[model samples]
Target: MAMTHLQPDPSPYPADAFAAFELLSSAILVIDDDGLIRYANAPAEDLFEVSVRQLYAVQAGDLFRDGEQLRQSLEEARRHLFADKRQILEIDRLGREPTQVSVTVVALDGQPWPALIELREIEQQLKVDREERLLEQAQANRELLRNLAHEIKNPLGGLRGAAQLLEAELSDPALIEYTQVIIQEADRLQTLVDRLLVPHRAPRIVGDVNIHEVCERVRSLVLAEYPNGLRIVRDYDAAIPEFRGDKAQLIQAVLNVVRNAAEALSARIAAGDAEITLRTRVARQVTLAKQRFRLALELHVMDNGPGIPPELLDRIFHPLVSGREGGSGLGLTLTQTFVQQHEGVIECDSRPGLTDFRLLLPLP
Candidate 1:
């Protein structure tokens, strides 16, 4: 099914004919008649894990494991100038998991680069879908948790007050101890309910926020708690500009993520190898919560710790779901609420030794 190797033909257009697509979110590749890659845009290079100069050095067929199928698609594309030919390919590359890429080939007649191929990694689309679903779930949980917390909160106060009065009138020491236990447990549950209601009561405090400052503050707070063995690293992009957001809410949101990572590193911390990295970068042409933004701030909180349990990965942000013993599980829920208030998103990816919590917020 391979096409006959065509001789080199001089293209009439300038070398930058496909310049407009370089900034496109999808990967763009322009293949010459000989099947040599003449141009690989930024996203394409990123998708293939190859630089433009290096991408040119390899034959186009080398990028995919099923080269014959790709060649057959190309042959068909070459025969029909106006037809759209598509194939899903597993891009073969080193040090990266094989990616499922949807390859779309469109023929351009009377052009130097006779074929334009677009490569879109399906994983990114799946990631967006996952984020949207998480956002919706978080919203629903917030409403349900708020109402449930209130329902439990009212009777809790009466129970504690009754226990206190019963303890005051008791003369037997053994029975007094039982009343004391009841009061203590009631107080503990009340505190938990107060935490559940905190996010709803906090007002949005808007201002220009520098993400680095937020990271630094969270680092300081986390280090104060786990100072003996934990190390916080800052990997920041100095060029990222400030955007309008709730500084306090952003601080709390990032704090929850970092703190959760730190908590997960308990074994690592005890072993004297705990580490958390706060990374910041500028994301362009980004979409969050269904709205597109020309620029967005990308913040990642990464930890070298035992990763989140696989069973709880999808529901970690839901209220009262925690992977750790004695965890209240409200941290990530509040974090999600705060980020969504600013029209942003928070997502987590975890494996055995690595965990990444990414926050994507549109920049003004």
Candidate 2:
């Protein structure tokens, strides 16, 4: 989907317009002609790490650590309608980490609002660049996997055929057993190759997808497998609207991640402390890939297990990199592919006891 620049709507204020502000990727602040904050979007709330109600109660100047510099910037913005200046400012909020953000201030022309301010994290810009690199790497990996599969696929048939013919010619049962083993191994490899190519061959079926429903489906499947001790918890925000996506593909993507968590929790499950939480929340002004959405869904799959091994953590999403024995590492690679197909991104954070896999997808 192409992202268009946001222009001032010519129509009179509509009820939906208010809700739409919550979806912007940039944090917006509407300053009254009197230099007070008249309005703030959801991203602004997140950027300042304050609730809208609390944000409204404080003076706009109090938001920045360098109040003097911000005050001067606001003054220049009001005087020059086309003014656009970039600055580094520290956010001020108690109990929250004091983080520096890259801020851009722009003066609005011929409107009730005097000026508007846009705030974005410096780290977020770095992440956007990193995601672009990861995307390029993923494309290369897909091509490599496809070519390698095809190479193995052709010889696989001949190898199996030769094994069958050898088994037929063997007179002694003991000699024939070796040929049978070769045939069985050949069939196993063929199945593995077929699995590797499934996502590329299947057409992406897009439709409206309710995130909680996908979570429920995965929860059911996991519970069926570890019914004794594993616990699946749901923390869903029912207000989140549905978005266009491939339901089956999403289900598969989410299931692969959750199932991996369940497998990792084998020890915890045996001790009755295993837990996986599926949490959903609404994110405002989130940028996925390069496009910014006014609203997006933040889904977190958190597990309590011996977290991902540090040595294998960085390469977890790379094709065929698995920490577990006898495991196929295609799960996260496929999950990342499915999410990217919907213009989304997946991130992971782990320590000794907690691991979180976050999926951010745009809302319709």
Q: Which candidate is the best by TM-score?
A: 2
How much does each candidate deviate from the true structure in C-alpha RMSD? Answer: 6.1, 6.5
lDDT by residue for model 1 (4-121), tens: 2344345445867877886577788777666667777787766776567676534566678787776666666667645668888887667767778888888877776668788878
Q: What TM-score fits each model?
A: 0.71, 0.79
Tell me the tens digit of each residue's lDDT in model 2 across 1-364: 0112233334233445457666676687767555666567887877776556555524466677776787788888888845788899887556767778888878878766667777888887788788888878877888888899999999999999999988888899998989988999999899889877877889998889999999999999999999988999999999999999999999999999999999999999999999999999998767788787878999999999999999988788888899989988888888888888888989899998999999999997
Candidate 2 has what TM-score? 0.79
Residue pairs in clash, model 2: 23-294, 23-295, 24-285, 24-294, 25-285
CA shift at 63, candidate 1, in angstroms? 13
TM-score of 1: 0.71
